[model samples]
Every structure is written in C-alpha cells, then in structure tokens.
Target: MTGTRTQVVVVGGGQAGLAAGYHLRRLGVDFVILDAQSTPGGAWQHGWDTLHLFSPAPYSSLPGRPMPHQPGQVYPDAAHVVAYLSDYEKRYELPVQRPVLVQGIHRDGPLLQVRTDSGTWSAHAVISATGTWWRPFVPAVPGRRLFEGRHLHTVTYRAPADFAGQRVIVVGGGNSGAQIAADLTGHADVTWATARPPRFLADDIDGRALFDTATARRRALDNGQADTAGVAALGDIVAVPPVRAARDAGLLNAVPMFTRLTAPGPQWPDGSITRTDAVIWCTGFRPALAHLAPLHLRDRHGRIATTGTRALDEPRLHLLGYGDWTGPASATLIGVGRPAREAAREIKAILGPGHRPQG
Candidate 1:
C-alpha cells in the first residue's frame, strides 16, 4: 500500500547487497536496500555454529572495509562473520531497511516496481542480491517421500549435538557434506555419500588461493588468452581444518550415492541397504529468484542471460552474487565486490546525469 521512490533498490541485505550498497553510495547513487531478515548479518546468521570461512579474515572482505580479525582464529567462524557484517554496515551508515519481504519485481513505464510486504519501491534500476540460502536444492531422489527417517538440508542443519548417537547419512560430495560429516564424526554414526568420489583440494590450498585462481582465469579471458585452470580444476572440497583433520584420521571417507531412499534408509546400486535414523542433504542450492518469476527473464536453461551483471532481456535489472555467471566468484565475500561495482557503474550510466544524488 505504501510507496517509495529511489534511483536503485537492492533486494536482500546480505553480503552481495551490502557490497552493491557500498559502491552505489560511493557513486552518489540515491538508493535503498531492503532485507528480508530482521538483522544485519544476512544469511551468515543462519550458518551452523562451527561453520568457518576457508580464507582468513582479510582475504574475505567487502569493497570499502576489511573484516576485522577475530583473536585466536585463523579462519573466522560464522559468528565472527556475522559480527563483522553488522559492524561494516554501521561503519558506513548504509541505508538499509530490514524485515521487508519482496513479493515481486515488475515493470512500470520507465521504472522498476519492487513490491514487498512492508511497501513498494519504484526505482530506475533493481539489483536482486537475494542469494541461494533461502532456496536449498535437494535432488528429487526416488522414494525420498517414502522415507520414514528425518530428512534435513544444509540450511536447517545446526549442530552435530542435535543428532548425537543416531545413524545419519550425509548426501553430497561438496564442502558442506564434508564439513557436516566431519562435525558429526564423534557425535553421530555417519556415512558420507556422493554420486562420485569426493575431490579434495590440496591440504595447503584455501579459499584465498581459490579466489586468486578465479581472478587469474577472468584476467586471462579478458586478454583473449586460452582459458586457464580454475578452482574447479583443483578440487571441490577446500580441506578446511576440521575436514582435513577428519580425513587424516580416516573418518571422512565417502561412499557412492544411494540409488534410492528406502523407508528406513538408502538402498545402494547393488541393492544393499544402510539403515539410518536421518539423512542430511548438502546437495547445494539454486539462486533465490522466485520474486523475479513475474518478469519471465530466465532462459530455457532456467538461467537469466546476462552481459556481466546486467540482464540481457531486462537491461534495467542486474543480478549480483549469483556466481560466475554474474562475475567471477561473485558469490564469495571478496569476489562479489567487482560485479557489484560494475553493476552500480552500469546503473549510473543507464540513469545518466539526471539521476545522480543531489548535493
């Protein structure tokens, strides 16, 4: 019912949205950020208690401010990251409105109309930074609905203590699965399952190295050189401290994915069954873009075609922090900065001289 106007509206006040806000403010763009969460930490607030960054604090920061180092921590944990984000927003006094659930984004003449639970915002450009946490992806494994045991996803997983003494199967070969399985090593009877063998990056490699690798690949492509190997070429898992220790202890071995989910547990391809009390799915997530469905911009491949961060079909809309499709490593804290900067610059160009913030 209520209505507001701004030059730009950034949806989702998470890391990506914050990065965009930093650049837009620097460029004197009159904008506002709407966050679905009530607080400043974004999705980091929901990460499991023991979750930690693969890179050190300085290597994982936004555009204008570096995350403060947590004493006695090489790789900061989830709580530390949340505290840093809370501080970063206040340090810059970024204009952020919280607890506003965006319903949809629609076109209105020359402006984009963002309808939310609290109110509506009309802006020349809109950046959808609503990352994937809200939409956890679980593959439709046959018989999943028939399973009698508890089924959980990475988003809902809190701590290993919750599943103490229970037999659990962790599905997925990615970092989350490895990390969760490691956490549950002593707490639960757990089995790690992946479609293929788990790939671990060199023990010495961390997120900082992976970020650098992605940056190099981007540069090589920009210069018209042959594509270089990226983080994926190195491995899937980052081998964070816990995971490394678990692997070294021989407690983190992964088995092949189950062919089907039985009432009690999972059935292997050979028809052998593993009776389990619960199954935790760390399969991964898709972008949280349901609000953009009204725009119908996604291609047949279920992706929004984009030139850098700007959507190809809808030039006034920009997608940030989705992943490499928006910009190299755009989903990571340090990586999201480049694309956010580029998106802000592009919005400024599109809005032209008249839309600059008033002195």
Candidate 2:
C-alpha cells in the first residue's frame, strides 16, 4: 500500500460521485474516484432488491445517459439501477477505484491528503459526494440498555421476510419507516413510531404533490423560518390536502407519538402501552464526514457548510444530493445537474480540459 497522487479526488462512487467523475472525464481533468463499496450505485445496491425509485425514469437519469427504462415509468429495481450505473461507467470509461474506505482527509501543505484503507492519495482538490445516508441515526432512549430484542437499523434491512409472525415496532416516520410499515402489515403485527409523520403522497395519479411540498419547505427555509424543528413540525408537506383527508379516512392509524420505551415495550403519549418483539430504527442519518478532521469544515449544526452549492472549505470540494442546499430542488436528480455541471466547470478551469491529471 503505497501512496498515489492526483489533481482531484472524488469520494463516494454513488450517483453523485459518478456524475462528478463523468463530467471530470469529459473535461479531461486528472482525477480519481474512491468508493467504499465493492461496486457502484451507493446505497441503492444495499437497499431491498425489490425497491424502485419513486421518481420516473425521465427525472432519474444522469447527465450523459438516458435511464434504461421507459421515460415516465417507475425506475426498475435496485439491481437494474446498479446495472445502469455499471453500464454508465463502462460506457464512458470513468476511472473509479472501489473497495477503498476513506479513513481521513487532511491538509498536506497546499495539497490535500486523502487516506484510504489501501493507501494515501494526494490531490489539490477533493469533491466529497458521499451522500447523507451512510450513518444510521438511532436516538438514545432511557432504559434502552435493559430491553433487548433483535434490534437493527434500517440501513441493514434487506427484506421483511424475517419479521413474519413477529410483533415489530418501527421507529421514525420517514419514507423508510412508512414503506416498512405498509410492507409488514400482511405478515407481522407492526407498529410505527415517529415523532412526526412524513407527509405521504399518493401515486402519479395525484401528480407532483411531493414537489409542491418541497416547494413550501423551500419557501419556509428561504424566509429563515424553517430549521430542523420547523421541518419536523410541518409534517408531510409533500402530500396534498386530499391525500391527508383520504389517509385520515382509515388507510392507516396515525397514532400519537411514543413518549418512552420501557424494557417491556414502548409507552405512547396516550398513556397506553404495546409490546414488541423487535425494533427497526429508521431515524435519519448524519454526515459521514467523521474522517475529515484535518479540514475542520462544519456549520454550527455540525454539518459541512456549503456556499451556493459548493463547500466553503475549498473551491474544489462540492456536496450533492442534499435535501436542502440552495432550495427544495437541491436533492433531486434534475436539481443536482446544474451544481454538478458547475463543479465540473470550475474543476476543469483549474485542471484544464479532458479531466487529464497534471503530472
């Protein structure tokens, strides 16, 4: 394990990383991509095999390639998306070095040192496209040490098959929890606990209510009225009023949130209690930037600070797939295209055309 040097290094081989790599390749910049996974597609590959993108193919495709599915259809299963990413790399010949976990990133004089499990890579600039899903967030509850049933984070979940005939409680109300609850109803006694339920949207027949919800949140954020607390209080802004009305009509019971988890079971705010055999924590994620101590880049909330879609620490570092950057559009595929292009353009200006590295 010797050290390698490059002009630029992109971390994480998921869609965002690949998008950056693709643009860098076209620009002929000298760059390398480092990813922890054995293959590409990031979290998508680890998700349940049957999972498909909520977005249609038209909106899900990356810059240079069309999604392999019909334009308006639901994107294929995880494997298909994985294959698409593989096809993308092969089709464009992007340089991706996989199975490398970035251990630390530090400033080595004018250049940056990226330490991986294999070795160190030196680059003038680094694009950290590692999205926010790697870290599973399970809250610390009182007496959690006492109650012991099989508990796991949503990140490790592969299928609902194991929960069959078992009583399961899913914590957190994000898409993962909601989907898990809906999926488990047939085989298991499932109870979902969320501090605040997400605003669930109906299928395409209801149109882009999800986008509208995003827009409202964006408006709130722009007004400086919505922080983490604000977003949580707002509930599912993506679902239409009618959908909420319909949901209230008894598709599912939205229980009052749980107040505490005793050793035996969880106690809800209503003074009632329920027992569970297992708990699936779908609580959100924090940044996977723990290895980046050398740069000292973070906001007051302990998140990587971005300036107009670029990291404030350096011109070469960029963050994509964040739900709230410039606005509500920041996290979506179409929304990320502009920022990705801009990052490429700036890196190309520094490295020159063809993404070719400087010797």
Which candidate number maximizes lDDT?
A: 1
Write one digit per residue (lDDT tens) for candidate 1, span 1-359.
47788899999899999999999999889999999999989899999889999999999999989988899999999999999989889988889998899999999988888999988888889999999999999999999998999999999999999999999999999999999999999999999999999999998898889988998898888899988767789989999999999999999999989999989889998999888899999999999999999899988889999999999999999999998889999999999999999999999988887665222
- For candidate 1, which ten residues in a row score worst on lDDT? 350-359
RMSD of each: 1.6, 4.2
TM-score, predicted candidate 2 vs. hidden true structure? 0.84
- What is the TM-score of each predicted model, taking all chains together? 0.97, 0.84
Top candidate (TM-score): 1
User: Worst 10-residue stretch by lDDT in candidate 2?
Assistant: 237-246
Each model's C-alpha lDDT? 0.93, 0.69
